[model samples]
Every structure is written in C-alpha cells, then in structure tokens.
Target: MDVRKRKTILFLGMALFAMFFGAGNLLLPAYLGYQTKIDWTSTFTGFSLTAILAPVLAIFAVAVSGNYFTDLGARANLKFAYLLAFVNVLCIGPLIALPRSGASVFEVAIQPILPDAQPVWVCVLFFGAVMTASFSLNWITGILGKIFGPILLMFLAILIIPGLFIGATVDLPPTIIEDRFYVGFHEGYQTMDVLAGLIFAVLLISGANRKGYTHINDKIEVVVKAAIFSAVCMLLVYGGLFYLGAHVSADPTEITRSSLLVHIATQYSGVNGIYLISILMILACLTTAIALTAGAANFFERLTNGKLGYIEGVITVTLISTLLAIVGVDGIIEYAAALLNFIYPVTLVLILSVLLFGKTIQNQKPYFITLIVTMLISFIRVLVNWFPNEEVFSAILNVLPLARFNLEWVLPAILTFVITCFALGRNLNLKRNQPF
Candidate 1:
C-alpha cells in the first residue's frame, strides 16, 4: 500500500480499537485475571475467542454480505431484518451499552477523585460532550483515531507497565474458579464486543469507503488488515491487565472490577496512578459513547426513512442514555446481562449461518426455522435463570448439550438449520424432476 493508504488503514485500525475498548473491556479482563490466577493462559484463550475473535469475524461477516442489515436479515426476511437491526441498535446504543459507558466513567473514574459527585451531573457533562462530538459523524474516525486513541493508549501503558512489574514482586493466591476456561468464556459475554461488532462494522466500512477504498476486494482487505491491527492492540492491553490482576497480592474477591483496577494502579504509583486511570477511563468511555451514538443515529435516520434526522437521533439517544446512566452503573449492568442473554445467541446464529452457508440459505424456510429455534432455546435458558427453582423448565433444558456452559442454543440451531436445508433441498429436486 502507498503511504496515504497505509496511514488511513492505521488510523481506522486505531479507531476500531478505541471503539471496542470501553469500560466492560477493561473491567472484565482484570477481574478474570484476578479469578484465574495460575490458569491465566487457558482462561485468557477462551476469553479472547468470544471477546476478540468472534467480534472480528462478525465484522467480516458483514463485509462479505455488503450491507449489514441486508446480509444479516437475508435468511429471516425484511421485517426480521428491521427488527434485528432495531434491537441491535437499542442494546448497543441508548438502552444498555451507552449508559454503561457513562456510568463506568462515574463509578470508576469520577467517584475515586470526587466521592460526593452527583451521577446525574456527571452524565450530563459527559454525554453533553459526547453529543457534540457525535454530530460530526464524518469526523469520528479522525477524531477518535488521531486524538483520543493515542491518548487512551498512552494512559493505559502508563497504568499497565508499572503495575505488571510491581505486581511480579508479590506472590499471588490460588485460582478461585476450578474451570477457568469456562468461567472466562462466560464472563467474556459481558464485554458484548461481538454484538457491537454487528453495528460498528457499518461505521468501519463507511470510514474505509470515505478514505477511497471503493472496490469490494479492497474494502474487504482493508477491513481485515485493520481488524488484525486492532486485535493485536486489544490482546496486549488485555494481557497486561490480566497479568496485573493475577499478580495482585491482596484479596481479589474483596474488590469490585473498578476498585481492583484502581487499587492496582494506586499500589504501583500511589496517587498519580489513580489519576492516570481516571483519565484513561473517561477517554475510553467517551470515545465509545461517541461511536455508539453516531452508529445509532445513522441507523435510526435510515430506519425512519429520513423522518428522524441524524442530529435529532443523537439528541434523543443522548438524553435517554444520560437518564439511564443516572440509574448507576451496577443497575445498568444487571439489566444488560438479562437482555444480552436473549439477543446474543440469535445474533451468533445469524452471523455463523451467513458465514457458513453464504447466500444459499437465504430462502425463508431454512433461515427462519433456524433462527426461531435458536431464539426459543435461548429464551428457555433465560427463563431458567429467572426462575431457578422451576424444576420442569430447568430439567427440560438441562438435557441439551452445553446447557451448563450457557450455550444451550448451539446444537438446536445447527440441527434446525441442517434439517430445514435437507427438507428444502429435497422439495426443490422433486419439483425440478416432476413431469409437467
């Protein structure tokens, strides 16, 4: 690639990295490190599968299909496509992820320095800036990549490098969870990067096109290269945080995710490191907030057929998310977990089906059957969580493979797809050979 192209790719990669590396991204790995102890290697491998690999693949899935909604919605039909897009927007936008970002800034960054700070005002000021930056959607890649991305990386390095070295001197405790890999895999869901990938892919593809990558092959190549670069950056930072969390000499169970991060920072560099982490959290959260707001606004503007303008979408999302953020980070987190359980499995099925079957399975019969089955199975899983004591439901669901692993939908989805495809294929053959 030429120098200009190379520069565009690098900046796009950085912007993607910043968008993915939000509060949940930072907190989950650190807490996993604390829990995994000596089994950090296997645990992190499992964590990386869901947190990094699945998300990157989701981006590729969208790229291959050419349009995010059209490709994703191909199998299920137009109405399903719109509904899925709408839910994806809400889950990753104002309803859950966006509010969590602001709440995280307050709980992890602001609360440490100003213990008495009002969350409502914090969200107001924070999202006020987010709203302003989000209005310039064309500039998101440049703003995040050229400016905030670098600063976020620098602060993370400052916090991580010293913590890793300092932590090495302290002997750590035994692993808390016996099944480290499984625990890490399950915990990785909380990051929600895979779901975000479906929406964020649109932004990345648009950014690449604006940078003059017009050819389909060129866009695919650029997205792949940029995703690789972003993945490498994420691995390094997540690895460093995990190392810090694993090596902390203090009682890991006693501390919350944000508190543990702050504790480690303060331990390594006293008060200065605390301030550094605070800045890091704010920037990380702010950049992601901007990206989510922009993505949602763009999608809504299109969804409403221009009735809802981009600026209006931003304003509406900002106001809603700001109010939700005031509900506090923990509450947002609790609610998000429930919603993710419902949506994520269906999304996974959609992405994987597209990648595996391509356009061949776009016929409504097979597509809808597979997704409906997956959703039904996943709903049962969620119901089990809601009513743990309901023996009838729990016992019925337990027979499915990986039910204990929170992956009860996998087998059912695959089986449904295969059976539907076979039935559809035989019908087509019979019709073709029959005498008119």
Candidate 2:
C-alpha cells in the first residue's frame, strides 16, 4: 500500500476501535478485573476471547463474504436474512446499546460532575451531538478517526497508565468467583462487540471504498488490517482497565461498575482523574452512539430501498433511542442480557457456519435447521432467566451439557448443522446418480 493508503487504513482502524470501545467495553472489563482479582490472567483471557477475538473474527467474516447480509443469509433465505439483520441492528442500535451509551454518559460523566443535573437534558444534549455528527456518513471516519478517536485514546492513556501503577499500591482481596474463566466469558457477552462488529463492518468497508479501495481484494485486505489494529487497541485498553479494577483497594461488590471505574481513576490521579474519566466516558459513549446511529439509519434506508431516507431513519432511531435511554443504563442492561442470550448464539453459529462451510452449505436446509434449532434452545434459555423460579424449567435446562454456562444451544446447533449437511450431501449424490 502507498503511504496515503496506509494512512487511511490506520485512521480507519482507529475509527473502528472507537466505535466498538463503548460503555460496556469500558465498564465490564474493569468490573471483571475487580471480581477476578488475583485470577486476572485466566479471566482476562476468557474475556478477550469473546470480547476482542470474536469481534475481530466477525469483521473478517463480513469482509470475506463480500456482502454482509447476503453472504450470511445465503443458507437461510431473504426473509431470515432481513429478520436477523433487523434484530441485530435494533439490539446494537436504539433498543439497547444506543441507549446504554446515553445512560452511561449520565451515570459516569454528568452525574459525577453535576450531581443534580437531569439525565433527560444530558441525554438530549448528548444525542443532539450524536445526530449532528452522524448526519454525514461520508465524514464519519475522518471525524471519529482524526478527532474524537485521539481524544478518547489520550484520555484512556492518562487514566490507564497511572491507574495501573497506582492500583498496584492498594492490596486487593481474593477472586470473587471460583470459575474465573467462565465468569469472564459470560461477562464478555455484555460488551456486545461481536454483534456491533457485524453491523460496523459495513461502515468500515464503506470507508475503505470511499478511500479508493475499489477492488475486492483491496477492500478485504484493508478491512482485515484495520480490524487487526483495532483489536490490538482494544486489548491494551481492556487489559489496563481489568488490571485497575482488580487491584483497587475498595470492595467490588459494594460499588457499581461505573463508580468502581471512577473510583479507580480518582485513587490514581486524584480529582483530576475523575474529570479525565468523565470526559473519557462521554466521548467514548458518544463515538459509539454516532456509529450505531449511522449504522441503523443506513441499514434501514437500504432495507426500505430508500422509501425511508437516511435522514428519516436517523430521526426515528434518535427518538427511540433517546426515549429508551430514559430507562437508564441498568434497566437497558438487564433487558439486553436476556435478549442477547437468545440472539447471540444464533449469530455466532451463523458466523461460524459461513466461515467454516463457505459455499458448500449454501442450500437452505442447513442454515434453516441450524438457526431454528439454536433459536429454540436459546429461547428456552431466555425463559429460564425470565422465570428463574420455575422448577420444571430449571430441571429441564440443567440436563443440557453447558446449561449452567448459558451455552446450552451450542451442541444442538452444531449437531443440527452437521446432520443437515450430511443429509443434503446424500440427496445431492442420489440426484447425480439418477438418469435425469
């Protein structure tokens, strides 16, 4: 790549990093660090697997497939493609992630600085900025990469460098959870980066094209390179935050995730640290909010074949997300966890199937069977969360291999896919042998 092309790729990577490094990305790792404490290595490993690695792989999967929805939707049919795309967009957009970004700003930034400030006003102003920034999708990479991305990184560096060193000063307690790896893996889901990665891949690819990467190979190479860079940045931030959370002298159970992060900052750098962290949270959340808003609007505009224009889509998303954000971060998180439990497995299976099988399993049977089975199992898992008290539901779920780990759907999905593939192959063979 030429110097100009390399520079564009670098910034694009930074832009992608900013988009994925949002509220949950900031808060969850730190809390995991605090909870895991002395067992930080194992826990962080598991956390990075889903949180960092999965998202990176997702970006590559989208790049390799050429079309985001079409490639993944090949086996499932158009309706399934549209449906899954819609749900994924909604989950990462207005319904959950978007609002969580706003709520996080309130809890971490506004609440700390202006104790009596109304969150409604904060959300209004915050989203107003998001709307304005997102209005021109063409400029998103430049805006996020050239400006906010650096500010976000600088703030993180200030916090992480000192926080890590200072955190070591305060001796911390034992690991709160016995199964550190499991806890880390499960907690990683809360970041939702993998889901965001799928949506954001479109945006990233668009950025590459606008930067004059017209060839398919060129686009894939740029996206993959940028994704690798983004992953490295995330790993550093997450590891630093996890370390800070683990070594903090305060009791993890006693403090909220947001509070614990702020507390860690204050401990390391005094009141100045609070301000840095506050700005960090606002900018971090704002960057993600902008990316998601743009992604949702773009997807809807295409979904409607421009019947709903981009501006109209933005207005609709902003309104819904702003309204939902009023429920606050905790509320959004509570509901998101349940929804993700149901949808995430299907998404993972889809990504994996596409990556592993390529064009071989493009026939609808395998995709339909795999997705339907996964959804069925996942839906039951959601119900278990909804009705934790029902003994019968608990007993039935307990019989599954990884039910306790909330991964009860994995085996069923794999088995269904393999069987469907085998059956399809046999049918193809029979058809070939017949005189037709």
Q: Estimate each model's TM-score.
A: 0.95, 0.95
C-alpha lDDT score of every prediction, in listed order: 0.84, 0.85
Candidate No. with top lDDT? 2
Enumerate residue pairs that collide in model 2.
Answer: none
lDDT of 1 by residue, 1-436 (tens): 7898788879989999999999899888887888788778778988998899888888888888775655566556667777888998899999998999999999999999999999999999999999999998899988888998888998889988987778877776667677778777877788888888887888899999999897999998888788888899999999998898888766645798779888888888787877887888898899899999998999999889889999999999999999999877778878787778888888888888878876454466666788888888888877877888899889989999988888888888889988888888744222111111
Which lDDT tens digits does candidate 2 get at residues 1-436?
A: 6998789889999999999999999999988888788889889999998899989888888888774654555546667877888999999999999999999999998898889999899999999989888899888888888898888988899889977666777776676587788778878888988889988999999999998897999999999999999999999999999998888878646798889888988888887877987889998999999999998999999889999999888889998988988898888899998999887888888888878775554466677789999988888888888998888888888888888777788888888988887877755222111111
| Runs of candidate 1 exceeding 4 Å displacement | 359-362, 426-436
What TM-score does candidate 2 get on C-alpha atoms?
0.95
Report the CA-based lDDT of candidate 2 relative to the real structure.
0.85
